[model samples]
Target chain A: MILSDLVERFGHHPLGIGQEIGRMVTTPGLDNPPLNITEKELTRGLRYVAVEAPSGIRGRMGVLGPLVEQAEAAIVVKNADYAFGCSGCARANIQLIYMLRRKKIPTLEIEYPKTREEAKVMVKRVVDFLRGLGGTNG
Target chain B: MARIAQISCGTEWSGIQDLLEKAANMVGAELFFPEVDLESIDKAVEEVGVNAQSPNLRLMTARAKAVVDGAPAEAVLLLTCFRCAEGVITKHAIRRYLQEKTKIPLVMYSFTEKPKLGELLIRLEALVTLAEKKALLARERQEGITLGIDSGSSTTKAVVMMDNEIIGTGWTPTTTVLDSAEKVKREALEQAKLNGRDIEGIGVTGYGRFLLKEKMSVDLVQEELTVVSKGTAFLANRQRGEAMVIDIGGLDNKVMTLLNGVPDNFTMGGVCAGSSGRFLELAAARLGVDVPTLGKLALRGDPERVKMDSYCAIFGIQDLVSGLASGVSKEDVAAAACRSVARQVFETQLQEIDLRQPIIEVGGTSLVDGLVKEMGEILNADIVVPRFPQFGGAVGAALLVSGVV
Candidate 1:
């Protein structure tokens, strides 16, 4: 399913339920549905050839490295709240983020809270972003 | 008469034979030993294949054909030693073969001491006469005087030439490039035994050249491309067309296209220190090898690079540390660093520039053997590193001063 569809179905809450699930589920070690991604698709998406980066900052920053390798295509993730909130991780992700932005990757950073308890509200935010709910935000 | 072939050694697909040949010609030596591989002798200084024949006489018989075909009697190979001085010579056993095979005398001249271009030319002139080639010396004819200055982000280089004869050259950090230019100009004048008033004109080029010229005066300021093309042509000392000029400075990188002594087009990278001079320096530090020796170590590695994901200097360093902790071969890691830098340069900056012909790489980074090899492998193009690649821009500026630009 398209990320937008998933975002609209559960992203309407301010608790960021949809955004948190997206992060946790997409993370390599985390348990999530949609584990059927193919080897070819993974190879196509492989930008970071070396998986030496530690899981935290390196993982998020490295996310773009592999994407850049594959056709230099744009990969948009909605995490506006995380964008402003992530502190030390910012340094690691800054260059990749800037490169993605400068390359005009159609990026949409959606805001979500850090704690899992805020899930309901975060879901609403994701839904709002996915549905093009606000004129100025889009 | 002694015949010598001068060649500059680096770890790469090809040796800087032309640079050495030019040096030999400068010293009035007519004979040169064809390059040889010294791989079997594991005890030999690591990767000393090209150096064995440079500044050393190879077997005379191997060069008999060249001698019969009008090559010089003594082949004096020139080399810039990473461990020692600018030039070092290792006499190869080929000298015996040369003496046995041909009637011509063979000799090698290694300059361990740093000598400016003017001093080098005078020594060459004297050596030519000493080799009893007065007639050849008279007919050799020196090229005109040309001056080139590259005001790089970190270093400033100046090369002077007169009638194809490199007269004098100088290099210093960009932080003090203006001062270095002034100091080197004076030094060149002193070495040439000519007053500053003797200079008919001067030309400046490079990223910081514009800013430098504002503080210091010059007769001309050609763009980086034109000066680089002219400098490469001068180093070739003959027809140099359809060549790529890669100038790696401390902060930025430039790739230029030369079509018959003129710059046709060019590309430049961002002013980031990540994939340029600073990157090499940082990697070398991380590896604990001196920057100059970094290339030779890298030449020892197999094909696969260290496989670091990020090209950024900071993350790359961290990755290098982690790789070393995991027992990755230092040489492989170094080679990988070179590959990473080369990939960025070609893919992002020189992507559109043609890589069909052998590329003549200039600038400070050109001195690195590993980067040269990795660049060739990645680009799948023949790469030629001139003997004094660092001075290409400076020499081009000097050429402009002589009206060649």
Candidate 2:
């Protein structure tokens, strides 16, 4: 959940906290999921998820499709957990981050805080980013 | 009367089912492949209650359990590929759980994409022999001791056996095949407290088996694969019914499938040192630690700290350095390196093979605790490290000449 309260406190709309695009893709007949997905949706999803390289499985791209479509701006927090057993999740997150960058949307990518000092830096960076996006609080 | 139920990856099952059934018939055993449906998987998952990270592995574990529980087989065989990291990690848990639940022996074999059919046939024959007999071949004590030598790329090992028991074993780093063979022989002789003239025959095997045979005038010379399969089967003894043999040497890695008491199919690593003992040595050197201590240091680190994807030695080192620079702990880096090598072995060497339970790991690299743990975790099965793991090749070589005059 990326700073939804903080972004809202600054008077800009924050997409729902803890919202995942994967849920929309997996669940059929969702109202806000990627629209007009056809039989070749699996292949189209792979085109976005496998932007860096061809992956063996494209099932993960279903999550990325709706996520990319729904987001106006994105904040990606990484390194909070290791990607040992969850390479698919990491790959999806990375693909989404890359897609946001390519779309030229206001994007912020930050590493998870490892120390108290780093935590302060993270908050400051988020606050600055929100203000730059025309938030009133800063 | 030994009925065996074999569970393999769906893809691998299609390729070797006929050959496997033929081998089973040859051994006087009936082999059955249980249907691994979603219902069985769900039931297994509910019973196990442990969440395996990979859905494929979760399903496999569940299916294996369901088969053992429902099938009329006396033993279970699990076939796994190298690319399935989840299988390696959960192999032990599955084996123990199933054995406790079903009271049946379980065997696992990891295979490569292209396995040697000849070697597979030999192993299958051995497994059938073991299953039929339910014990290793019994031999009366013979006069004079035989020396067995395994001349590998990185280490030379020698074993001296008297009256079907190992009297002494010795190993040292390889300089030349002949020199290392002689050095190990001398050490074994000294340990056995026997004179040089007491040695009646010398058997040789390994990558330099031919060289050692030519240099030392050996009495019996067998292929390294044959000796290793024999040695693992011998060491496992009755446990051979459910045992899978994995030998990770300096330059090569071998995986053998045992059904009942026989070795059925086997696979070996390619020319790359990416998954061999040399890879660990280099990674340890880069970390300023010895290879033997790599496992201990890794156990001390959090296994979930960082996962490295690269299996190439060069790329692995680069990943290690990058991980360290990124503030990953030293122990975690060490663990990641070990894990990476283990993963590489599974991906490159054992990708197409079926892995089963009670895996027996031998060879010089088996001495490392971290590698074993990593492999065990990846396979999720019981790992058996026999006494003198590194001497298995030598012991098998020696056994060939045990009854010889």
Best by lDDT: 2
Mind giving the per-residue lDDT tens digits that candidate 2 earns over B1-405? 577777565435437666666766765677776656776676675455434555666676776676656766656766656444444434434554575576454555555565555444444544444444333223223235898999888899998988778898889999977888888999999999996789888888876876876677778766566567667666766333556788988987887766653454456666567888888888788778899888788877764666554678788677777877878887887788778777767655553345767788989888888889998887777688887888988987787666444
Give candidate 1 misplaced runs (Cα > 4 Å): A1-138, B1-146, B238-240, B303-305
TM value for model 1: 0.49
Best by DockQ: 2
Per-model TM-score on C-alpha atoms: 0.49, 0.53
Q: Please report the TM-score between candidate 2 and the true structure.
A: 0.53
Report model 1's chain A TM-score: 0.33
Q: Which stretches of candidate 2 lie over 4 Å from their true place?
A: A1-138, B1-144
Interface RMSD of each: 18.9, 12.7
DockQ of each: 0.01, 0.02
Question: After aligning candidate 2 to the native by TM-score, how far in Å is the CA of B297 from where it should be?
Answer: 0.4
Give residue B66's lDDT in candidate 2 (0 to 100).
66
